[model samples]
Target: MRRALPLPLGLLAALGTPLPSLAAPSVELGQVLITDEAQDELIDAGERLRETPGASNLVDMQRVGQGRVASNQDVLAYQPGVFAQSAGNDGIKLSIRGSGINRAPGAHGSGVYTMFDGLPLTGPGGTPYELFEPLWLSRAELLRGANGFDQGSLALGGAINYVTHTGYDAAPLQVRYEAGSRGYQRRHVSSGQVLGNLDYYVALTDAEYDGYQKHSSGSAKGFAANVGYRFNPNLETRFYLRYRETENELAGRLTKAQIKHHPRAANAAYLARDDSRPQPGSTWVGNKTTFFLDDDSRLEAGLVYHDFPMDLREGPMRLKVAYTDVSGTLNYLRRDTLFGHQSKTTLGWRTTKHLPNSGASQFVRNGDEFGPRSRDFSYQGSDTVLHAGNDLELAPDLWLTTGLAMIYTRRESAVSYPADGGKVSLHDWDYAPRLGLRYDIAPQLQVYGNLSRSVEPPHPWSLIWSSTVATQPIELENQTATTLELGARGDSVLGRWDLAWYYAQVRHELLAVEIVAGLPAKEANASPTVHQGIEAGLDSTLWERPGNGKLSLRQAYTFSDFHYRDDDRFGDNRLPGIPMHYYQGELRYDWPSGFYAGVNTQIASKVQVDYANSYHADAYALLGARLGWDSPKQDWQTWLDLRNLTDKRYAATVTPGYDDAGQDVARSTPGEGFAAYLGVSYSLR
Candidate 1:
């Protein structure tokens, strides 16, 4: 038996060292300690997400807005244990602590859940790609692992919620534009207003990019709006609307040799077929109502409807899909004193109904010409979940947290093609339980630990499209895991730091593997596996003065150890895809005069490409820098961002595959070369 390593106390001690006190109060500290009405009104919307007893992070858009905000990578760069690699302007491969590490580009069963505000972005079919714009968000909250139980997440990777700006928190008027290398350009306009008892916010954005690789161009246009009515101080309701249309050319992947010699070239096969995503779009509307039962209690309910249409042209196939989803949630929260200690309890229920219509056609060599129909399918799926949680202050400095979630899912599908008429159905019931404890060592320090279980049902689409059973059956077992985690987070005189260590034993873990060189990856259940990792983040103030400004260093490091457990064939080989070590760091300086400059770098270790652990992607490091100015009036801001300063040629992401007798395959997407972006924004209160 392999013994687990002990937590790194020395590393934590080093990061917890004390530093000189600032002459002025730190906004960071104020965020944690201040609870006055004025301070509460000024708090970022994501603050509540950070109060979880497990690993969680809040990204304030104000900080990220200083640089290029192009893709998910830009928004999640400083977060530990999570990796979002850009495959193209509109494609990002996301993984968290080995979750979804085996999935290929465009695949969506990653166990990670995504949301917009409180609305589910990952529908019942489990797809959340090419659906978001960073500029539209006010902040984002990442709750790792079972910490996301509050959001009805049933995945090992947890959930991320993107919170948008509201009339009360947004600028009265704003305009922003960005232009960058590779024909990148974006423009956005927004307005917010409040009248008597009503408030409204609206935004429109258009973006275009001719990617670094050939045939990788993409464009998008989006509109988002929301209106709120304050029935009274105790009750309020808001309605939201969102629409987006996107189109992109697919570049496909390349082999090691090709990546080294012609990294900017698109796959020959993809180019021949003119592979692309044509006018993929979505429309969504939703409403949320909240009622304050009392000072310590509240009730909230919300409902959302989404209509999505997508078209894709692969080498010789064209697939079109129409998806509709209706989802809703009801939640209640209460706080009371239990045995003289503070206590809080929450109850929530969520449900979603998904309807999807899909069809595929075979195409000839003639571009945009289709031959005979290949497959057609219609699917109906529904998921209902009930969850309850409680937090009890066991003592003056100790708290206990517990939660339970029960989920029921059902899927029914009908297929028609080649005279093969059939119907398939699958149903599953799953439960997740979590227990955690947290101790406050000081006003600014905390340590927490949790033991939890997670369960993820296969996506409805995966059950029909990626089945690997000999009979091609649609029934698949749920992916389940039991995890144990320990962590510490605090702000010291030196800086703010968050560190965590976790180990998980997983059964029926979902695996995506490419059996053929040119076909899409297929999904299957793998043997038992082990996932363990260390996630650490630090923000240190190296220098500070009230009038002179400040110099700060931010760093995030993730160490992942994931492998099959004595598998029948692979025999404990490392799972392919994610690197064992990844690190990102930045040194930034800000002046009282509203000027700021920062240099950042990212480094990753070599990653295994095949289950045999024989083929691998070479390690690479990227450096970048940004300089910006913010007017004291907070009305105008501008910045220049430089990326890939060294112009390193490397794979930004890779698709997992089985061993092919030691031969390398074309399954890697090359990283972008040196590029620069300039952005300017103006806002009025």
Candidate 2:
């Protein structure tokens, strides 16, 4: 924290303040104010992100904690161009710009690169959900679409970086407890401190719940820690560690009628077999080192190790999957003067690969009893990319940006248990290039445009599971797209607003369809497709009184139009998972005494349930309210959250089938009904 000394009488007199009494001249000084390191860091991060010529969002976890911070779904609310919904467990369906929209929620999710504290968390297989405890985060940054090029993420959905709290932003000791309907409970304890040039932070958390649907309970426990040291003004390093384990029971999907009448009933098959997914454990360890070459240049290097193993007991089979990945990254950043103009340049290299022992085993199951082994398979994959980018100031208040990247990808999958097991191995090279420009129309307004390309590789494990024959592996090509985007963001009379429009010409687009009720879906390369969307967000201070309170409104809306350009069978049919229109808004009133109340709503259009558009999941609107109080000294907090106030029964998520023929298939997960929760926390600073 920084400070300023009290004003001297002489300085006040020089500033033309009149003295009331010469014998006893009095001076009145206001209370000392200290800035929160975390808040300053968030502002600096947002300013840095605004330099990019694309859309992005910075999420403050502290604000999100006022209500409920259950999962990523809660953490990512009110973010335009992003769709995240829970699948009745830790698994959530997350998509950006129609990426990975159809696949069912599972142990691993795709189409985006995820990170924790700037270290790799997404690898060749995909992103795991076990270690994402929302309370461990200080903030989150989302780079949508190709805006993540600087982070070495070459995916359709770009990247998400979760930043954890450090000693500078944490209290010395803190404890929290939460309880609510359906027997939900959670507890947490954490501590952080700074000593000389060294700092450390650690936290422990656990949660359990009796879910809304029968046989859908779940529990989790986790810990996160980090330590950092500054050797000198020019050198620094930090180490990070995270470990978590979770077990959740499964309730199979239900038909439209079932959700309307018996929303809390589990599917008969799921109840009979007691289906569940229990993650044995997940761990991530990493270190990052930085070298300040000079005032205008720097270099950073990082290495990470990740291990996530799963013990899945669902459907008619039990699968034990072992996944481990290792990654390395290096980046160089510098500024220079070229042709008498200011310029900034960056060069980076990164790679991620699966370990030798990454594989899975399957066994037959009946009524919670295991049978003989059925199949054994191993997955192998690696990704390497070298990229360079530059931004040049062509004129005052104007910038030109350009970048290119070369990528190498390898995938291999083999069935090793059965005799003469089939195998598939493929390697390919691809490239992406980008160009963009931005100009400051005024200090409070700016306009930007970018033309870029994106490439996404199929997961190695998908090759084995997507096959028609049980013992064979299939080969598929990489998905690629060329996109054009135009956008602007700035302050206006109404409030802070952002609006963007983008269109992509996708080639060999990857699509997944459910072939069976309880098995991995089949992924195939589509002929061609078109993806277009509009994203808008606004935050306004509706009313304010200096000594009383303030009223504010925040809103986000997305309009998506994604479809097959020309297919022999589907014929320009719309995608089946995401809705065409989505919106979320919150109207809140905050009092100067640390009390606040808010009402929020979420609305979405009908969603198609099949590729043929034979049927749909009906549109729905949800209403909720939150009331909370934060102590003036920031030592304590308490809140009450009410959800689904009208007790509306609707499908919260959908897993599309190939062709239901207009039948209301068992393909939707019911949303939670009316519920209430209470939480409180105390901190000793």
Candidate 3:
């Protein structure tokens, strides 16, 4: 049976709650079906909200029906101030608070940190992993700014944690299948049960898709299992493991003309001197082991290995091992990314059919390494981080949290262009510090703030390996950002509201700059930068009637100003690709007959193209809804999701030549028009 909830505006106002600047309605009231873990972390609905120490948020699985998220990019599309952009239609790069803008294919260097379960996914050198697939994410938590003090690392933008579901709490046996736009299909199965003192979960997922462009066929398969044993009321142990495989053909990006003629043409020739069909694909496998000592202490470690057998691409193979210890009072991490032994290459495509497609394809290397018979190259790095914190009860209702972290990183790059050539090596060291705190005010209100620092070490690519700088040893470049964050959160008659403001001062912002007249370029700290933003959110149950569940609403809004300080070329430019205004809202109503209806929307303000800042993509909004029914007696549910309910044709990307060239250079990937998906789920005991 459903429970009653507080009314959105009426209840909140009646409780004398000061509502944040809300852009939409609040969640409707009713019995909040919270998970066990969530219940343990939060004090109560009315207690002061503290998100740092053991903070996490769960996206209700029952709310998201069977619609396909074309790519992992859609997972956080509704997040405030977050922008997910695709160079083509298949690959995506996420920008948070102006971080990760320069991230491209094979590019290494991430301002943000990404993790799965408790293990780090990004390599030791902060190289972000490609979004393999979004198959088994049970819940996702985005810890930003000082909110991530407990998890020690040189995190600038923030950290994203994806928790996969386990079988213990899942249905005994469940299966699902779905297909969608551009020849896409998927199959998934999961199972879980409890026995005495043990619980277990296992899941399998497979997906294949012929993307919106040429040669854009991607197929992936994954399997995962987790087992937990509760020794007693004070201690619990759990084991988790996952394996994934993928084979994708690169059709690459298309130009404006190609997109207009064939929306799904992956083989379109857009770059005259470019070749993208090098039979490109990669295989990666990862495994993790974790043990929990107590509710506040955990020890986790993992290993990741990847190999790439490319036709024309020449980069590096990856091997990484990481260990992390998290205690209520202290945290520690040791991570490393190493290049393995291997020397090989494949033939370059000779036909125009294999030409790479892109709005700006000149950045891609056109010629292949012809004389490179045998080459030995090694690039390795290790990051050691330590943090210590303590919680002090200042007053009955107020609490203060103090913490500090020290990070030490070492990097080495050795290279020999040809077989037995004279080898050269470059090395460097970096150090960073971290700090933060939270405070509770009135009965239901809390204020938290933090001042921390972060840094990005130089990548192996910056150590001078290209023929353009064969003899010039490039210097290591590092960046430091000082960030300040303040926020207030509470639950009142108005529901749950959170408001925050953040500002950052960055020094030595890294960039690839042309240093010498006759030489190519070197990675260098271009200049300083400043980023500031304001955000507000609300969740509430608007109304409720006995047995009719309740009407719930959730919404968030952000206004950000990201720009650079010093240096030439659009100084103080509104950091390209970041939307100044972003908003998301959802309204849902559930009933006894298992009948449910919901409406969701995402809005983005106009954003500038690349660094030129001469061109910009227009503002756009997409609204969607879902209607479904479930059987009360039978374990069955079905739903239809209508995405992009309003037909709106908008270009997803546009890149103009420097100095406002003549060509439009727009490669608009079509946002899905109004489409409906019908899905069904069943369980077998």
Candidate 4:
């Protein structure tokens, strides 16, 4: 028999409390609000987020922009349970909660779902990399595990939503410029304005870098814009458009010996072929509408269309793909009093259709001529999801939340090359369930626990491609896991802290194995495995003097313990690619005059690099510092950032291998050395 818990009243009290009086009337983008209902809606939305019963975090982009803003790693450095490593200027590898931990370099599959302003960035085929720019976002929301049910995401890694600034949140005019080491330069310009019921915002950016490693360089250009109209205080609609073009050279990986002696050298094979990502680009358009039904209910609908073109050269292979994606979502949220207690319910539906017009793979013997057509195909994929969840108050301070999701996916492809006519189609149906309880111990403290199931299907590329050994196709079974989690968050005299512990039993876990040196890894289902970890974060003010200055400390730590569970082959062997211990911290001092300085460090324990558990990468620690001045009037700001101050030589990331008994191959990408950057920004309102 099973029993359900009641919803907690602490969240309702916290959100319903009256706010303090403001010092002055707020004016945004020189526009005076015509009604107070809009402001109330915003506040209600924020309160609802705070009431969630699981691990969730909101990152303020303004705080992240205070230092180096060049890469995603810089932006997500303080996020617990998230690991982001830079492969180059335009490429980044990201994983959360052991999700996609064994993915190969440049692979098109990810277990984590990513979105921007309520629009899906990951297509139905699960290929999502390269769609983030911190400069264009106002905030980021991270929902871990089952906490993302409201977003209709069933991935083990959970979901991330990047929210962009609107016309009301932007300045009338803004300009920014940055110059850094290795011939790096960036420039951005933006403008926002409002006329009658219409509002609009636009931004343009250009960047170039002579990368840290030899033969590694890149350039990118982007444009983003949004236009909106307010039909009434209860209804509004917005349209978004974005375009970007990028070209980058590959430096490739290096051996441990080479990393130690000549860390900046490019791989010989990569240099021979001049491997590069040439003219990779995308265009996106989306529309979102929201309707507020009374004070207790709201509905949202959105649609997005994306066009992507990719061209790449890797060693002796040339690949080209023309990809298009269409997605739509509908969500309804309602809050009411159930049996004289507060109750909330959410229902969401999402669908995505992906089409690849022509995907071609060719072998090239010379510089400009294609040698042989290895593969050519056209594909269509679709994904549909329905999710519903409810939170009901059972007692004064306790709450119970339950949710379920049903997912259906299909893939169809026709092969036109290889002189053999063939057709392939696959379909799958999966269900995910979640249950959780929350209790409020105090006004500022809370504790929660949850149990959930997650499912992930194989990407189309993985299903169609072949393993390096060529013994069989690379089509893998869907990965599934059952997880249990407990967490606590609070603010006290000591500081603000958020901590969580989770354990998962995974079946048919996807594992990538490097069978051939200097080639893409092969995907396969591994034996039963266990993933457990601890995520902790703390932010505290050590000392403060009224009207003088203050000192603060911020820290985040992650402990990952992933291994096989009494397996037949590699019995209890630890999984590869992730370090057992990873930590990041910062100490800063600020003055009343708007001057601040901070020192930050990152540390990682030795990591296993192969499934055999016989080979490991040495541990490393890096230190960096930054000093900046921010005007109190928010008119001007400048920063000087210094990274890798000690110029340490270490691997930024390592690829996983099956066994390293007699293999001596390069499998690591070297970290950057000492570098400096200076950035300046000015805005007019």
Taking every candidate in turn, the Cα RMSD to the unseen true structure, in Å, is 3.3, 9.4, 10.9, 6.0
Q: Which stretch of 10 consecutive residues in model 1 shows the poorest summed lDDT?
A: 23-32
lDDT values for all models: 0.80, 0.84, 0.52, 0.76
Stretches off by above 4 angstroms in model 4 are 1-46, 356-358, 363-369, 467-474, 662-664
Which segments of candidate 2 are over 4 A away from where they belong? 1-35
Order the candidate numbers by lDDT, best to worst. 2, 1, 4, 3
Q: What are the per-residue Cα lDDT tens digits for candidate 2 across 249-294?
A: 9998888899999999998888999999999999999999999999
lDDT of 3 by residue, 1-23 (tens): 11222222332242337544321
Badly placed stretches (over 4 Å) of model 3 are 1-62, 85-91, 105-109, 125-132, 229-237, 251-376, 419-435, 462-473, 511-524, 630-634, 653-663, 666-670
Better of 2 and 4 by TM-score: 2
Model 1: per-residue lDDT, tens digit, 584-660?
A: 88888888878989899998888888898878889999999999998887788999999999999999898978885
RMSD of 2: 9.4
TM-scores for all predictions: 0.94, 0.94, 0.76, 0.92
Error of 4 at 494 (Å): 2.0
Better of 1 and 4 by lDDT: 1
User: Mind giving the per-residue lDDT tens digits that candidate 4 earns over 103-220?
Assistant: 7545564778778887787766675455556688766777887677788888888888877777777777889999999988989899877878998889988889999889899988
Q: Which run of 10 residues does model 4 get worst, by summed lDDT?
A: 22-31
